[model samples]
Target: MKLFKNTFLSATLTGLLLAASWPTYGFPLLIFIAFIPLLMAEQNIRVSGTQKKLRVWANAYWAFLIWNLITTWWLINADLFGMLFANLVNTLLMSLLFLLYHSIAKRVNQILSLIFLITLWICFEKLHLIWDFSWPWLNLGNVFSDYPQWVQWYEFTGTFGGTLWIWIANAFGFYALVQNLSRKTAQFILIISIPLVLSLWMYTTYHSTGKTKEVIVLQPNVDPYKEKYAIPNLEVARGLLQQTDSLITPNTEYILAPETVLAQNLPFGNFEYSEVRSLLRDYIYLHPKAQFLWGIDSYDLVYDSKEVTPSSNFVRDNLWVNNYNAALFINRNPAYQKYLKSKLVVGIENLPYKPILEPLIGNLMIDLGGTISTKTTQKERSVFTGDDGTKVAPVICYESVYGEYVTGYVKNNAQFLAIITNDAWWSDTQGHKQHLSLAQLRAIETRRDIARSANTGISAFINQKGDIISRTQYNEKTALRGLVHLNDVKTFYVRFGDYIAYAALPVMIVLFLFGITRRKKSPSYYWPR
Candidate 1:
């Protein structure tokens, strides 16, 4: 009877907590307090009868399964069959992790056990980031996305550290509210104060202001399926050129187009350099004042006949190699510079985990038509210089989530950010919105203005404070031309990268060790089934 009651309470609280994250049935306070009942249930089971360990582990697994399936049901949109199968696999993995957690918790002291759990959770989140079936989408750290102000410290520790903060707070808060007050109240108060102090520190540090620039973002509602198959390349190019004519105004300095806007690759370097040069010259001649930035598939061929040693040869250097996903910077003065995107999206763009999955999944199908696919492996940060020498760093679709990578660009002196994406793939689903929200953090991290252009979606200009000064509505083909701020003011996040979260790893290790050593301290606390 008691087992049923505890399981019921655990299931209910876990469900409620998970549901609080979904838009359909969400309550913010429920998100914070919901863990209390569930945590307490587990804590009570810790000191129960003989069979307590297995019972607690089983409930933990069940609760995690509930949390994941309830909150991340949207992953089903990936593929009906694959998503269901993936969820089952994920649930089982989570169950095993929880079982490990139960064993470790039993071995450690209370405080140490909490630390171990926190560390293990962080490690799991990190592992999910780069693993074979990597999906860092609904990481617990993202639950605090709505609470951006409290997460201002993410610039220093990254958002994974923010998850650690919340987990620690929950542990302390649970102790303060449920456990007896035996001078542990001070510890609880201190634990809760961490986020508060960091937020206050950030609030004070964000006072310095910077200059803003006028930029234009193009949200072209181009369906990849239709663009590639139904419509002719000429028709698409004509439409894009016509759209450019309609959108460009006197105030528009930087005009951004969505990814793959130029269906065909543009010639770069000295091969047909004259022709390549002529096309851009004509473009600049037509729009004599506007500085144009467009996403184009670019081709490169070296024609420099300068003699060099074998190793120093341009051919050997692969400088004359193939094309790249590139950004064209055409200034009104007839000057042009192209930048290739570096950080490619893992599965879609470049699969570093391709070898492992190739034998298993046997090539997943892209919904859009393509018999074979090419993997992009570009890793050099390409910076484009504006007419005034303002260096702009560009990240393509799905690359915005890599805040650490974006930080690397800022460190290398990329002033403004231009992210070209095609959200049309997801239609008007939460996928696009979530992707856009994640991009917002890039601005906060670097304190630079972001000019984002998306296909069939939310195009916006993000400011230094992570605020969107102007934004276009989703699912509309419209031009958003506004001044985007470009400031060199580097935030603390750039100085010290993901330090807070990484520091928790060692702390977690210590906690796990403590848990194992303290098993004898509570030998009489096991429960009978």
Candidate 2:
């Protein structure tokens, strides 16, 4: 009982440290040593060699649960059930990974065991990106988002690089402290310092030089709960236009509006006939040189002959249809291009394993005051080409969280990124703030200017270096006019795309096999009874 209490205390301390070092609040420096206490708890369990598995998992769960709750409790503002489900399930997944490492450590040398832990964690983060229940908000790489100058190197490695950096620093720092080796501790400091120094140097030296385009970003400040759906689409369109009319000039190359600015669900086939389209068409008629990109809730119905997809919703009379949370781009041409949001939020936008889980737990889907449906997505990462040959990546709300996923747009020749989101659903909580901060990482990774238009404020322009040039107040009805330089160059991260996580997969397999094959070893240190 005493041993359990000590381990539990250590785990809780670790969780506190982790939460205290997250972005949008707290110091990121603590992350270097955040995992030490939990690791010590796990080590104590392993050394004791009695009820090792159970104790390790339990301790890890406690730590992860506290961490999840502290950092993401704002989720409850959107959905109480979703908040609980995310915290419990994500913590369970993290604890299971740690438990796997604990099992591997028992049979292998300490160095190999550490390697397995690092690689396994990276693999887990990688899996989180691709999986149906992906919640990469706590991925260690994102810790540096609030301090973009410290992670200028993200342009080469992506967020996974930051994840690897954090893990390596924590592992080495923990080892040095455990063994009480001053020289090893110095080495850990050096390991942590080199990256910071390099990031600073790169941040100071880098500069963006290219054709500049003036952008006007709108924040409609429509309440998702009361005003968004209640107001007519034409009135919403007129409001957005009225806000941009004075701000936009002939030099205004792009006008960005928040996600679902047109709250009404328009049929994809007759999108041109919609009043929302007409308003935009009239605006484009006046400013023929300027391009407009805004979010819309759209749907399309397919007859019996049309092929059905996994996301298709079926109706009576052999009819199937799809609902899209999409970005519509209107240029001088009569035709407009649309990019459907691919990276759907777990319960709000998408139902994971829908063919199986929907029947069982479908009603549990949380309604965050937006279009709640199994949203359809497009396969291609579409880039919106402008009148002057410049291209912009139309990144929807949740899609901005994904690093490699956004790279697809840059790879397809997007010059800058335009992120449209409705962050009002979560209100004025850390949920929206964190979402805005994560976009900084994307800006640095892609090395492209970002024009973000949020529904309830935080509309801003981020430079190539991930610096917020100008921003509006939260929940404000305002518009931000700024000039974002258009660059044709692609960064190394955009070219390679999460290579660090991909490279870890093979190394993790090898380490896991080696750990399993090696003979069992006793700990070098003693555990307190």
TM-scores for the candidates:
0.81, 0.96
Of candidate 1, the 10-residue stretch with the lowest lDDT total is 307-316
lDDT of 1 by residue, 61-105 (tens): 676667666765665555465456556666666666656666776
**For candidate 2, which ten residues in a row score worst on lDDT?**
520-529
lDDT of 2: 0.88
Q: What is residue 492's positional error in candidate 2, in angstroms? A: 1.1
**Cα shift from native, residue 519, model 1 (Å):** 4.9
TM-score, structure 2 vs. true:
0.96
Candidate 2 regions with alpha-carbon error over 4 angstroms: 1-5, 362-364, 524-529
Model 2, range 1-529, lDDT digits (tens) per residue?
2333488898998999999999889899999889988888888778775788999999999999999999999988888998999999999999999999988877876667788899899999988899999999999999988899999999999998888888888888767665656788678888889999999999999997678889999999998888887787889889889999979887887999999888877888888988777778877888887788999988999786467787887676778778899999998888998989999999888888888887887635667665567888889899998887789999999899999999999999998999999998777788899999999999999889999999996888999999998899998899989988888888899999988988899999998887778776667522222
The C-alpha lDDT values of all candidates are 0.64, 0.88
The number of clashing residue pairs in each candidate reads 16, 0
